[model samples]
Target: MHVLCTAGHVDHGKSTLVRALTGMEPDRYAEEHRRGMTLDLGFAWTTLPGPGAVAFVDVPGHERFVSTMLAGAGPVPAALFVVAADEGWMPQSAEHADALAAAGLRHGLLVISRADLLDPELARDDARAELAARGLGSWPAVAVSGRTGEGLDALRTAIAELVAGLPAPDPDAAVRMWVDRAFTVRGSGTVVTGTLGTGTVHRGQELELDGAGGRIAVTVRAVQELGEPVETATGVARVALNLRGLPREKVRRGDALLDPHAWPSVVEADVRLHGIGGPAQVPDSPVGLTLHAGSAAVPVRVRPLGDDVVRLRPDRPLPLRIGDRAVLRDPGAHRVVAGLTVLDPQPPALRRRGAARRRAGTLAAASGVPDAAGELSRRGAVRTGDLVRWGVPGPEVAALAARVPTAAGWLLDPTRATEAAEALDRAVAAHDAADPLDPGIPLAEARRAAGLPDVALVAVALDRAGDGAPGGPVVRDGRVVRAGDDGPPAAVLDAARQLHADLTAAPFAAPDADRLAALGLGPRELAALERAGELLRLTPDVALLPDAPDRAVEVLRGLGPEFTLSAARQALGTSRRVAVPLLELLGRRGRTLRTPEGTHRLR
Candidate 1:
């Protein structure tokens, strides 16, 4: 199904034409029926010959309801612009035309209504010229009379051709249905109607309602399309959703029902602006304005960044994305201010002097299109989900794997990755130079040294450093180390050799604190020797050869199975401090057994 909105001046026969085409009255309210003019948005549908089903959102053409007209036209893809034969064009006609053009409506048809009252050719030519001035001259034109049904068949044929030529919407796109109407039924709790531009809505599906109240969780109790209950409703169709959560009054017209986590709620965005009449039509100061996108009309503060670009700070966070188009209006003048194409939904803060001017220069090159490489490079790094929220479609995000290096759900820029790798190299080199005996820096410390936000990025930088490079960084035992760094420093190894020579001469004579101090064997150096299997530290103060315990066992065996501490110390030529702990270590290792009298027995 295709949905199209009506645009024209008041009393231009927009609703009358919709009623005649669909065989149903579009004016639902009693006041509208009596007044013979649309006061609010109305709905009607019909099946064209080749297009199957088409829906018309009959919007009011009155000047007072201009916001109402924008609300209807924002979500619909095509338009049915009406012009009466007797009245060629009017003030409301120009405003509505500006609205349709500001909305970026590409497919539409010009209908000259009440053709029986005068020659429709004159009205058609004037309408065409007016549309041509607004850059909409290619649309097809038809003459029809709602009262006499003149040229109704040709009008249907023109609509059928227009609907058939529209670009197909992605059924798998993320769901973001802008609510146009909301109410409560006696049986059902709440119901909201919208035009589902893409994606599908099914029964029991969960969606988020984003608006001034912030985002609230909502569930789909049921789905209906064209006044009939359905299991699912696909996009480009008018749908009424039976919601499970929130009261009818809470769900307002500007709220949106969206796929959870699929959109970013932004309070400020940078946009490329296009004025309706000319550059002068857009305000240049930070003046208060209203921004209308989809079914939302929000008050905003504007800051001009360039001649054709501006920054908007909305009163409330909006679920907007890159490449999304919206209309800016001045409520005081009740006029269309400008059209905007979003460039960045999440922009950096302009805190430094001349930042806004520099930002203007940066935004001047933007095409208002979502490019994965460009976005990642601009931010240095970002989460993959953020790209989706910024309006790069899921397929483009998936394609990032081939374009950049991703780690821990983040897409990294190539230059940023290279800089991180260089930082890691500098950190390792600085650490090694400061302490030659230190093996490497801890992973967390390395992450901080590299100025990375996440610890997981440490390994990524190490990998990017290229381990095969000479003396490149590598991870070892939770520490980032230089490649080919296997053992202790050369100075520590030389000290270990001297300690080994001393213990080898008098097997069990452990080194004293004074002797170890002379050899420069500190705790770290001693521990390094212990790791290399060259020394065994009985305690912080006692150190001996690695095989001292075995040699002591053999010596004790020579003195028979049982021996006292004094006897063992005399036999091993060591002090009581070394004898006591060494015996405990032997007993713990099952090499010797201790008696109740504090004697030692070889196992």
Candidate 2:
């Protein structure tokens, strides 16, 4: 199955031709029928014996409904361009062609409707010349008159040939079905019709309706193609799914049902805008406009790139991946001013104008190449859809995946990796310059000060930095300590030898910070000493050098296997500051037990 949309001027016989082919009136509303104009979207499907099935999305041709026309044409892969034989060419015709081209519709058939009303040769020549000027010279053109049924069979044959050459849709990729029509059936619950662009939909599969964060566990009660029931539907097929859970009002036209995990709910994108003629000349800062992609329309603030490009910030959070094609329209004039392809769907930061321009240049160059995914992955992970929007052929996307660089399942850019490494090296050098006495800066603090994105990137940088020299100081938690400096501080070393003698003579007590300060050890000195791997400062007033507490524990355990805080204080010859912290540490370590009764016992 193939989905195609019609575009041309109003009263160009678009609806008449659709009615003639499908034998179904496209004008659904009484107002449309009475006014003899298509005010809303009209849809019909036809099945040619040899060509299989094709769906027609007939859009209103008036200039006022250009936005509506865009919404219908945005998702279709091919189109049927209608031209009235008498009119030849017009402004709305050019606008429709420009819109189709901007939305990236490459395959189409030109239908010269009302051919019987004009001289056959003149009409043929005129239509061909008009299409050729729009760069659609190779498109097949056929003449038809809905009133007389003249040339209808020939037009059908031409349409069949055009659709037959189109690439078979990929059902294995992520499912992205754009809803063109939604209605309720009397017996059935709610039926939504759309072109299934990718992936297969089975009878009872749960799929998420994107743009609305809503999940409908649909039991595909029935499937239809060109009005006939079918068992399964694949990509390129126009499908009417009889959904189980959602109501008629709940599901609207333009909603997409996509693979929940494969597609992101909200993506930050980098877009390169092609200025309408050359570039928009704005003396003042650029203003915001609405960007239309697929069935989703979002208001975006445009940040211009000197003269050629612009960055867009969408107002509504949309489920757009990298490589999506969006049209930026001037909401005030309601004219499409530029077309854009998403580069980074989730960018790191929108900072540094110069850096953004450089990145944009790289993306533009990559997008113009034959292997966009490979080029993008060589830089970083790019969404597969982004590669398509960049104009790379679909078959090449999988081939480009092999070229991506991965480390522990995370993709990394070689250039970014190198930059991170250099940044870390600079950080270490800066730290060494500032704190020569310390072994090295703590890894956590180094990571914070270096201002890199992740710890893994920092680790990669450190590994690269240590390639030439002996390894620097070891890092534990957030602390940096020199290797082999696990002994007591020099001041604490002297104090420990005396404190141990004092504790042994008395039995279970230790000195406080004031006592250590009296021996020339202050807070700053103590911090340096701790970084040197010396004494552990248990509290504001309490201190312990290694091995002092261990000996004190043994003396108390041997004395009576249990002791009171008062008795322990008397034994170690210390005051409450040293006695309390020492007992608390022992209790915390489970080496000695402490009770609310103030009794201490060896565990």
Clash number by candidate, in order: 0, 4
Model 2, 194-252: lDDT tens digits are 77877898777667775454554445677886677878788877788888877778777
Model 2 misplacement above 4 A: 184-191, 212-232, 241-251, 265-268, 274-289, 331-334, 348-359, 368-410, 435-445, 467-475, 479-515, 570-575, 595-598
* Candidate 1 off by > 4 Å: 34-36, 277-282, 357-365, 431-453, 465-467, 484-603
**What local distance difference test score does each model get?**
0.86, 0.67
Residue 119 accuracy (lDDT) in model 2:
55
Model 1, position 228, has a per-residue lDDT of: 92
For candidate 1, what is the total of clashing residue pairs? 0
Listed in order, each prediction's TM-score against the native is: 0.82, 0.82
Cα error of candidate 2 at position 452, Å: 1.9
What lDDT would candidate 1 get against the real structure?
0.86
Per-residue lDDT of candidate 1, residues 52-73 (tens digit): 9999999999888999999989
